[model samples]
Target: MLKTALGRYINNFKGFTHEVWILALITFINRAGTMVLPFLSKYLKEDLQFTYGEVGWIMVSFGLGSMLGSWLGGKLSDKIGFYKIMIFSLFTSGILFILLQFVTTFWGLCFAMFIIMAISDMFRPAMFVSLSVYAKPENRVRALSLVRLAVNLGFTAGPALGGLIIIGMGYQGLFWVDGITCMIAISIFAFYIKEKKKTSINKDNIVLSDLPKSIYKDKPFWLLLFISFVTFMVFLQIFSTLPLYHNEKFGLSEFQTGMLLSINGLLVFLLEMPIVSTLERKGVNKIKNIAYGCFFIAAGYFILLFDSWVGILVISIVLLTFGEIFSFPFVNAVALSRAPKGQEGQYMGFYTMSFSLAHIVSSKTGLEIIAHYNYQINWLIMGTLGLLALLCCFWLNELVHTKKKS
Candidate 1:
């Protein structure tokens, strides 16, 4: 019975198409290469003797890089082309990671982190834009979900694997591994992945003014974007403070903390797609799912307030995972649905930018709090903000429904 069930699972894996698998493969490589940093806070604090304020500033620099990169990458996608932008981003990011080997000072590390963060964030909007262009509307969610799965799986493996590397080879080995993997990823994209639309085939320039005003004028989309913005801001702060919390308050090791962070990715890897499909079929409104997600995430963060052990942590992880599955995909789907025909790339740019902008602001805010006060208060404030964002999601849903009716 066990063998038969295992065989069936293997069959399902084989059933995935070449294109889909290729997309997932490249995404996995990219994410795996990038996973070094989530656990780097512990390294910096313990090994390098950096203070909380120093780490906060370093993180904020990364956020600044991401904010600028996401914005420019979007515009550059229009001017230079998506695939080309991706090529530059992947290679440049790899080079930056390798450059980290020589860095000793806090300033040097901050600069390196900035370059690495910018290039990696730039790769994403372009990649997603390409996915939107290539995949059919009906299959888009599934395709994106596959990519998401690759990311989470890579994230799941990367940190746990990274923990071992940190243990055996030291912190610098993490960067060396990441840099080499990035090169491999770039090579795969360069040789294997072919764009559906060749840039050279189109000479006609698409002006920003020619784009749909719906992105600006559509109240529902705006509301949705705004609500999403707030929640993302709240959520992104967790990464900035959580490592410090575990180290100071709980005395958790890098491996243990990495394990905790990995739980978030592992949950998404196991369940995002099945949940998306089931909820889509169940007549559950997408916005409701998103709102519920925010509620759950907030609740999960608040649960951390009680200082529970593994069992309670598992419960909190479950809540945040469900929230991530529902909210992340729903927001993306809504953005795609709202986009003007043939301008999917542009819309996805703005869509991604919303999250990027939120992340930058939130990280900066979290840095300020940690700089001034404590993690306990910062987490509480962030959790409350998430609840407020959940409330806004209901208003966003009403607007979308009204617009659809008209």
Candidate 2:
């Protein structure tokens, strides 16, 4: 039984095209070297000695850049093709990441972070659009899961490597490593994936299957966006606040925190593909699965309410990792499925923008709430947001089914 289960797990990874695998490889390299974001909040607060408010503003700038980038990447992918956008986004953002180490002042750092994130995030929507082109329609979700697996694997490596780099060479080492990896990741992509003309259209020179052309008319999409925003609002805390919480509450070192965060990545890497495969095979509603995801995340946050026990942290992360595994891949698949023939880029852009917006709200609100009240209050608020997302997911499911009936 165990061997059969293992074989099934491995089979889920099969059938992807070469291009999809390359995309996954590129994602792994980039995410593995992405040492900056996980440590950004800690860096601003401790290394720079910035107050919570200042750190919040810098994070706001980061999200604003991500929002703009997400919007532009999608819109342009429709026009210019995802190929050009991916190349330009990665190469330019790499240069910016390296330069960011020099900007120490509060305002300067905010502006720099904004610019860096904007360029870096453009790769997201464009890459999603690329997968639509590269992966077979039936295999798209697995393709997405494949790429996410790369991301999780990278997450596992990045934090551990980042911890070593920080302890050995200081924060400056992170910027250089991140910048170099971005360039390296993209260079392989640019070399291997030559631009194919008239790629977005099929052999018939038109898109055959798609939803309505205008994304704005879709109420279900909008509801999903809101659900995603709420889900990620709680989710983004891991990058921004949770690290601080680990150090402050438990007095863990950077290495310790990295190891702790790595467990979430490790869990996702091990479980997401199999779980997604099982759910897909069962023909469960994506929206319902997302609601389940919302529940898990809310439970994770609420677990944090038991502050007295350090073991609660591990339990909380297990739940949150499950939440991430459930939420993100399906979210990507559903957003891709919604795009009309030429609008893949735009749809993905808006989808990613929701998370960017969430990042803006999550970091700022979380920090401010902690500043004004306490961590307990913040946890309560995040748990509430997760439940709110769960409720919205049900409403979205209804809208989708009703629209189909109509």
For model 1, the superposed segments whose C-alpha errors exceed 4 Å read 1-17, 198-214, 308-310
Please, what are the lDDT tens digits per residue for candidate 1 over residues 249-297? 7777778777876898988876787777667657689889889889987
How much is the lDDT of residue 361 in candidate 1? 75
Which candidate ranks first by lDDT, i.e. highest? Answer: 2
Residue 282 displacement in candidate 1 (angstroms): 3.3
- Reference-based lDDT, residue 142, model 1: 67
lDDT of 2 by residue, 118-196 (tens): 8889999999988888888888888999999999999999998999999999999999999999999999999888875
Native-structure RMSD, model 2 = 1.9
As a whole number from 0 to 100, the lDDT of residue 375 in candidate 1 is: 65
Q: How many pairs collide in each candidate, listed in order?
A: 0, 0
What's the TM-score of every candidate structure? 0.88, 0.97
Model 2's alpha-carbon lDDT is 0.90
